[model samples]
Target: MKKRLSLALLPVLMPLLHACTTVGPDYHVPAHAAVHAPQANGPLLGTKHPAVSLAPVPDAWWRLYDDPKLDKLVRESLTANTDLRVAAANLRRAIAMYHEVEADNLPQASVSAATARTQISGESFLMKEKIPVFSIGDVGFSVSYLVDFFGKLERADEAALASAEASQAALDMARVGVVAETVRAYVQGCAATHEYEVAERQLALQERGVDIARKMVAAGRGQPVDALRAQAQAETLRASLPHFKAEQEKAAYRLAVMLGKPPAALPAAEAECHEEPRLRQAIPVGDGAALLKRRPDVRQAERELASATAKIGVATADLYPSVSIGASAGLTGLLSDLGTGQTAHWALGPMLTWNLPTNGVRPRIHRMEAGADAALANFDGVVHKALQETQSALSAYTKELERNLALRAARDNASEAARQNRLLYQAGRAPYLSSLDADRTLAGSDAAVAASDSEVAIDQINLFLALGGGWQNSPDVTK
Candidate 1:
């Protein structure tokens, strides 16, 4: 009899199973996203220079400088930076949420046991009768499986998976940021130290000039005003030393914090470095196609769009009825007869749930559609922003390279002019004031060169950051 009953239900269930259809618009990569990639996937506009190569960008770009201290600092920051830690935590949470939604596709089972005292009363026979209470025991096991006749759970799983991917991308983005910032801090500290050294040398030269002016005045061969002018120049140069020192200290403090140390726990060796690290070869900047694929922000935006699109299906699924197959067998009786066959019972069937008041469902679907639209727009914006940043960084780096070359040439010319003026002064063929002017020009030129060098180093780091390297091998925090 039970077999016949089960056979009778199969025909009714088969049709519902075969009719399952996912109810929302399917997701595809938006057409506008690929449109933003440069034509022919050619080299970026700013990459047509000797300083930039079309080779693939390095995953660990900071190592290009071959500075052991910088390498160690970047490694430490990647592991210990607080921002990365937070992002890792978020990724873990997202993964867990995805798993939770994924579980809906499997059978849900539950076991329950209970004991209660019950009383029976009889009063409808026209005679009142007292009833005794007795203990009852019940034990049951049940399982239910959602039919997913409308692909509701499937869409939920899709949305959750996309969200998890977005979280992973966000973590990657954070890794890139931490690495770039660590390199920037180290480079800036070293550059400031170099500037400080240059200024100290220039101040020493100026002090000697002041001494020479004083000596000439004492010998009644130079005016007192000449000594005063020389003294004033030396004081001005002395004023700049503190600014460079402050810059070095600030960079050190920033670096220490990034390494998960206190601000006062400065990296002493890094602070003492007087030369900023430089790359020995052209920067490897792959074409636009690779950049679009490599950038984490772009990936994040794309995943968010996918998630939003899935949510539309989720909302649409709400408009239909939910169906599930349920089965249970249990024994229920007085304590004295709980295990008897007479107390056995069983039930097997399908359950249908329909939220009849669906006036709000369509509105929710519209809202989800709007959200997807916004996500699509955001994705396009992120792609364009990534390209813009890369192009701008490349342009700035190349222009700074040109400017640096000009400044270096000016520095060399000023150095030669100062040397000639000093020789002429010693031979009594040039006035002391003329020599002083040449020395001042040389000092100014040296400072300008130092400042320009720092700018170039900073620009290189920025370009690498825009290239979105250094996160390819980021640690798996979700584990």
Candidate 2:
């Protein structure tokens, strides 16, 4: 009986033996992976300075400032920011979906039991008038396995895994955004504070000009119009104080939100940061090749393309036949004969299913192909956009550096001229009008220098953002 049973199972196992053939084209990496490669020489169009450095950007690029306060704020934002939390949840969901798809490769089994009572009428037979009642009971176990003759299940798993990776890349991108914005808000607040200080200094200088103008009038060496003109200038400078304070408050509020706190929760030290932090050295900007590798948006696009390629295989596999094997064994009998072996039964077989061409197979294949093409196009677009943004940021940063240098020189010249005018007026050589004009010129130059200083810091942060830093703090998110 054992030998007969083994022979009977041979046909059921035959389909599984030949199930290794995969039907569709396998995915391959594209030949031109990046749209634009870093040129041998720098592509920066501004001043001919060495293009920063060819070194790879550090993960925590902001730490180059050496500000412990900035480092602490960035760390806090990573842990508490609501947007980053949402991205983490999305990554977990994608990983779960991949596991769900993987479970299809295993065999399925189930058990069943039932009991019923029925009545049969004897009147259905000739010359009979009575009815009889009987009880039936049965229990069984069954198993089923799908033979993956065309690799449909494997391709599905491949697609799911790629999607999970794409989700991880998206989380990295969110980290980059939050870190850059937090730094930007902090820098702006400091810049505003510096501007306000510059304004106050200018007001004191104008008040001294007013005093000189009055002294000239009392000594009968000048007209009253000169003193009135000096008074008007001092009033004008005073009017601008409220505008500068509002700018500083706006930046403070934005920084508070970036740290995931109420506007009133800003730290006292940060609110009083009246001096701007300056970078001591040139920024490090790696080549375009490194940029393509480090940017999260580019990675996400490439993974999406891989997922779409795998889905084509899954859809095309449907054009072929599916094979399955199933087996069942059980016992059934009247209550009186429950212990008898004569009630035993078993069966095993293989099943084949196929769709005729009249069914809509061709249209489904077309749909999958179209989706794959769209994904490929999207990947190319992302690469181009990344290169464009990087180049634009480099040019802008370099130009801002050049402009700041020029402003510094002008400020030095204006300060010297103001000193000379004050000395000459005290010696009775220059008129009070000449000293007042020199002081006004010096005040304007000071404000311009402060504004330019702030812009340099802002442009530097923008360049780092284009290079994609800040994801280093949460290294596991990329994995």
Candidate 3:
């Protein structure tokens, strides 16, 4: 009895052992050559913010600027932006697709029933015309399975899972891009306001020359050309007035919309310096591994690579012959003369499906491999671009910092030069031409300083984008 039991179990266990063979290929992370990776270079600039202690990559990093209005606006944008909504929708779709793929693990069964009636003419195959109409119905359960004998189904599931992960990461990238844009637009608007004020002051100075020329002409001490030149200068400044006002208003409206508010409802600015935001500085460059992990687009690329790898297995499974056993058991009713009979029918045997993979399947397998290769390259590209951006941003920020200092010095020098030249002219030693030259120099220098301030702020925004830090910080939506 023991021998017979062992003999009976041997055949059953034999197939089960071989069933472990996974089709196509099991994935391994592809090796990549790291290029121009950041050494996380930076010096701690000044005292760290009180809110930030050991640099844990704070949530809402933009809010660290300590501006309540800005904080509110960013939060509003996060909730209202249509582009963000689209990204989120895509994420949900990916999740559904993954779920659909996962459902393949279980048997799928459905039920059906049918009834039909038909009439045949005598001319229609004469012998068949004698048959009467009939009603046919079937009620049964059948489950067809590929058996996952080689983990083929599971590999497909893995591919779907990777796709879902990629979608989620894409949403992160979108989040980073939009908030950076919002912050930038707001800063530009504020800077434009400053430029407009400068134009106004210059226009006032030009008006003074117009008045002086009128008096000099009445006393016969100045030419008409002098008054004409003064008028032209004043008009030039006036012409610029509309442009700056338009730009500032545009920025303000954009900001209001981003904050999920009506464009007409922005609060008045108290002080220009107070409106000029200085983001939390001493930007910490975290670990390379962590940086890679934090980047959504990079992760999405890697996930696509994984999905492609699994496809290689799915394709390879086609190369081998598939053997399946099938059986059908049902009831049939027949009526002959006055008799009715019910019978059972069934068939059982190994069914073999065979075809050479090299024929129709080889091209597909090659395609899958090619796709995987492309995905790997894309992954590498994203990593390289990310690193490059951070490096470039750091260099840019450093330069802008230096540029701001130089512009400040230039502004001071030009301002003092104009004041001194005017004083000397009042003391009757400097000519009117010298005073005019000094005024023009000071005005241009002030404009340059204002422009440089905007550049510095813009560079700071770029750094945030390069680092892909918005997601880490839970950035507010861009309305």
lDDT of 2 at 220: 84
Instruction: Give the number of the best model, judged by TM-score.
Output: 1
The reply for model 2, stretches above 4 Å from the true place, is: 1-19, 33-51, 110-141, 218-222, 328-347, 424-433, 473-479
Give the TM-score comparing model 1 with the true structure, all chains together. 0.93
User: Considering summed lDDT, which 10 consecutive residues are worst modelled in model 1?
Assistant: 32-41
Pairs in clash, predicted candidate 2: none
Candidate 2 lDDT, 185-239, residue by residue in tens: 8888889989889999999888888888789889887779989988988998888
- Give the per-residue Cα lDDT of candidate 2 at 120: 62
The lDDT for every candidate, in the order shown, is 0.89, 0.81, 0.68
Error of 3 at 305 (Å): 1.3
TM-score of each: 0.93, 0.85, 0.82
Write the residue-wise lDDT of candidate 1 on 1-479 in tens digits.
66576667678668778888998988888765653555625679967799999999999998899988889899888888888889999999999999999999999999989999877665644558766788999989899999888888988998999999999999999999999999999899999999999999999999998998899889887789889988999999999999999999899998988888898776487546789898989999999889988999999999999999999999998888788888999999887898899989888877767775456988999999999999999998887788889999999999999999999999999999999997887676888889889999999999999999999999999999999999997766555
Ranking by TM-score: 1, 2, 3
Which of 1 and 3 is the better model by lDDT? 1
lDDT of 1 at 10: 73
lDDT value, candidate 1, whole model: 0.89
